[model samples]
Target: MTTYTLNVVIDNKQLLLLKENCYTLCIAKKVRDQLGDKYNVVWKGTADFTQNNQFKWAEQYEVFALKSFKIGALVEAASKKEPIGHKQECIFNDSGVMEHAKADPNLGDDTFKVTNQYGATSFGISTILNGEHNTSYISPVIIKGHVVFAPVNDIRVWFALKLPTGTMFSDFTGEYVELQFGGDKTTVTVCYDDLGSWKLKDSNPGVVG
Candidate 1:
């Protein structure tokens, strides 16, 4: 499990991965960076996508506690690269991988770095990610589930799993559903079926609808 503490200083914040190998933590930071501030992460844990969607990347999950961080605490990160130990291995999957990595592929020396915008310059550090699960497409597999009714005027109706990314729904038919990447894992896909207007059983964070 990758562990890190987010330290907020003045207007800037620092992400530090406290572990023997900085690989997982670094990857998590990159993903979080891409996510911006929409999602909150307190402590991220292992993300599991082990079934149905064969690809590990697509099944990947980041275990983390959520937090709606204050924008005022936001700061820029300085970027750079560094190296890790040669003996150290970066495996892509959680399953047995040492044998497959018998010979180092020489991903080469150097990895990325990020520092808090805070005045403290000590935040810069080097980290490495062994093997990364390739995430080209996540299965838009069908979901055999049910929906629920939320109060009117509220965006939430019902929720469903197995929705694809970038799906769109319409009200022209009186009620339509749309599935955006929603978030990191696209937690819930809001849609309607033969039943009355509905949504994913579970709603996306910060999304009332």
Candidate 2:
């Protein structure tokens, strides 16, 4: 069977700085500079994505940054409460998913920064399919507590890789693709079934299995 893997890689240099002094604003700035401005590195603590799609618990001492992309317009529209007409629904089902998938071959590994109902910045993956977009699973790598207060000071990152359900191996142009995040790299193995439902596969920190 062909297997699909999704991997998350963290930048060690920046991670090291945070590990040295997670709470120090100066060190946080240095880390952010090294990681680039696009990432969501904050001096204040950040919230992790939850199953119920809520961000809770505000604590000091941990610092993190993330790079995320915006969801496609059609996918976004389908997700909202606004009424969708039959013609729009048909177009969405027939072409919406594939268009989004092809638009971003890196979709599996990239982070999508989404705002929840409460206006908190939550990290999660959005599905390309009509209803599935709302159900996409997101797992984030988080660093907790200050270096002084926390026993472990490690950087953990997680991203989701998804293919439209029933996508066959033959559907892709290549058997494998390599993805680079800063100085780190990861591989993803994908599997297919007749049901055509997207599958969520988790990978090791740097390796996908």
Candidate 3:
């Protein structure tokens, strides 16, 4: 299991619902330092996929409990020889990611960033995410990590991976749901491949930048 370390800064705010447990977090293989820096990331499966088509997102049964949730483990990661990223709006409110990665070759990285939880800069404001889960295609995959939701936080934010129905859970999972970001929607799908690469798709109609 290739341990995948990611710095999730709520890549988008339109998916974060702290009180509602609705979030969409994503991770890429490479981060650019300039406009033309090459970048890439492996795509993999996760512990938060949709059931049939009813939105089986990875929600914590209890946020403040002792029970823990398990996501998939990372397999591998590398930098791709692709063009740098474009200027996109960052949004992270009702969004949030996991697990074994599968390589799908090295592709270009075209992603945006936003956070309503207040910017990390001294010149930014702390915003809040109020958008609904109307996304079309958005899924994140990482590797090997353990985290507890509720029963551990003393709040209703239960972790430990639970399907929307509170039936089954896994070390890592995947989800296929659309989010209502501002006024757009896309069929987001995240997962890991068998070749040890991570996969992420923001296939919304002009949704993801």
RMSD of 2: 20.3
lDDT of each: 0.21, 0.21, 0.21
Give lDDT: candidate 2, residue 33. 16
Over 152-189, each residue of candidate 2 has an lDDT whose tens digit, in order, gives 11111222222222111111121222222222322332
What is the alpha-carbon lDDT for the whole of candidate 3? 0.21
Q: Please write out the lDDT profile of model 1 over residues 91-188, one tens digit for every residue.
A: 22223111121224432222111212222222211122123411111111111121010101111122222222112222112232332332243334
Worst 10 residues of 2 by lDDT: 25-34
| Regions more than 4 Å wrong, model 2 | 1-112, 115-123, 129-134, 139-209
CA error at residue 11 for candidate 1, angstroms: 47
Residues forming the 10-long window of minimal summed lDDT in candidate 1: 146-155
Ranking by TM-score: 1, 3, 2
Alpha carbon RMSD to native, model 1: 21.6
